[model samples]
Target: MPHTKTSDEVRIAYQVRGDGPPLVLLAGQANDHHWWDGVRDDFTASRSTITIDYRGTGESDKPHQPYSTERFADDVVAVLDELAVDRTDVYGTSMGGRVAQCLALHHSHRLRALVLGCTSPGGQHGIERSSEVRRSLVQPNPVDARQALLQLMYTPAWLATHPGPYYTLGDQSMPTYARRGHLVASNRHDAWDALPAILAPTLVLHGTEDLLNPTANAPLLAARIPGARLELIQGARHTYFEERRDLASPLVLEFLDQKVPLQ
Candidate 1:
């Protein structure tokens, strides 16, 4: 694992693997780079893949300070600056998607393409998860909470065969404050008005069955960004890119490879 220091001096950990065109993979809330374990190789087969452990997870230094998606995006920019990557495509899911939005908005020069999955713009403009889904996520027992999260992230059939826990549980070792910071940052994300200004070719993907961020946000995201495209995977859940990467990865690759007229 390689590391870079942000302007704030927090050490952010990142990994670069394989070769060819670059693609940065951003992790979801409280999750580390391993969140992409199931689909990383797919992208890496043809493109150099860069994965970053946001300031509060994996091997990164976690400081007890406020976190915002914009700040998280800056952490990514620091990593790219350290690696000498001038521009690359990006794929982000859940909280990672929120961070990606900020990255595209704040550092437009650093991206060639963008893919956002199962995430919202936050604030009052985005569609929130249902109250029932929200309650299930906060169960006192870790076991119950993990199970509930799995249910929301994958289909019943997928969970039936893969009973073992995946990356959906996030970093169990993450500090309480770091977790809280991630939650607050995600809750405050409001890129609705700014999305239209994005110049990179963008793709918004969501599972039709996604209950966490809700599938509606995908189309909303696509519509908000000028000339962005939306794709909904049928029968999949929040982590559709992971659970059905077989179907989703190709869409991402195709979109990244296509040349869209500059907006």
Candidate 2:
């Protein structure tokens, strides 16, 4: 149980794998570090991958205080600092992408590259999840939540073909208050104005069928962030990186491996 203390003194539990350049994997609103279990091997084959539990998720602290993306971004920076890593590539999905945006804007020097997946800049400028998807998450039981996620976060073919993985992806060990804190914090995130300040070379990937963070957000994010590229995975939903790893992983690896022109 490797842990790091943030500036705020919150304990952040994290895991590291492989032994090349560092790559951090940031989990989403409803997930902890364990959420990366499904795809950690894909990146660990080359890069030194790091995945951490958000303050209110997994093994991190939950103090009942208000949460913000800035706070989460700081935690990421603290994790890197604790590991004595000056900079590293980051792959952030959903809510974690919002945190990544904050990091890239505020801690530009600490990033080698960035990959934003299934995320948005927020406000009316970016599209949102469907009402059906939204409604399903409110106070739903685990069984219901799993079913809804499988329907909205994954394509029918992937869900049908990968039942085992699909079921395992539903694991969420965080408490209700903590999960609610993440939701509240994520809802308040609005980084549209901050996009232009992200100096890190970036790749914006989105699933065409992602109802959580609509596909339109991808191109919008890319256009706003200078030098950012966009790629839309066909028929993929929110969890495309896992549900459609065969397609998503290659793009991520290629992007991570390529050299970013000096600024």
Candidate 3:
């Protein structure tokens, strides 16, 4: 519920919980801080957790203007500044991973370790979701599109066990322009050329069965970021960190535990 102001004066909302070394949790496209609900306790048990709502989502001020991953990274830095957190580990999912890429690139000194989950680097080199999968989410009926998204997010078994009327992480009632801005920013992310320059020790985590950001992109990210480690969660989909946290959280926590020589 705390807030900070970006250089451009947009109010960014964030929450800090627990105690110890700081770990920042970045949410995916259209989602807010609540996106990390499933696995937050794992990290917070040993590290302080900082969850942020990017400029256009959650309780943050949403200006009807262009949004870029680089700008979102800056918004994150502003929150860290407000809290006097000089360096911290980062774990980002989906579009949040793109913003994390920008953070590692543009603010390398501010990071300790980085974790990227179920995301792509964007541009021509990255593997995109199949046309069939993409089309499923853009259906004419909003209800149908949401159902398609639910399918992509989890396996049929999980969905069968958890009945819906449940909404996704991001509020559906958000301004249409904010959603469009998030989409454009995510589409335009291209950190391939600059990835090797990243100083933080990094981990790339992806779902083996992710339909949104195809799993193949995981290796590309691991190969590009210097000394980055990759882990693929089997039988998992786009929100695997939530759906398969038993497999994913331990990997993230163990990676975060290893010491990296300070920059």
Q: Which candidate is the best by TM-score?
A: 1
Q: Each model's C-alpha lDDT? A: 0.90, 0.84, 0.89
For 47-103, candidate 1 gives per-residue lDDT tens digits of 889999988899999999999999999999999999999998999999999999999
Q: Is candidate 2 or candidate 3 better by TM-score?
A: 3
**Candidate 3 positional error at 244, Å:** 0.6
Q: Name the 10 consecutive residues with the lowest summed lDDT in model 3.
A: 164-173
User: Which of candidates 1 and 3 reaches a greater lDDT?
Assistant: 1
Error of 2 at 110 (Å): 0.2
Clashing pairs in 3: none
Checking candidate 1 for backbone clashes, the offending pairs are none
* RMSD to truth, every model: 2.0, 2.3, 1.8
Q: By lDDT, who's the top model here?
A: 1
Tens-digit lDDT track for model 2 on 65-178?
A: 888888899999888998999989999999889999988988999999999999999877878877877888654486787677667777778767776644224236667777
Cand. 1 Cα-lDDT: 0.90
Can you tell me which runs of candidate 3 are displaced by over 4 Å? 164-169, 260-263
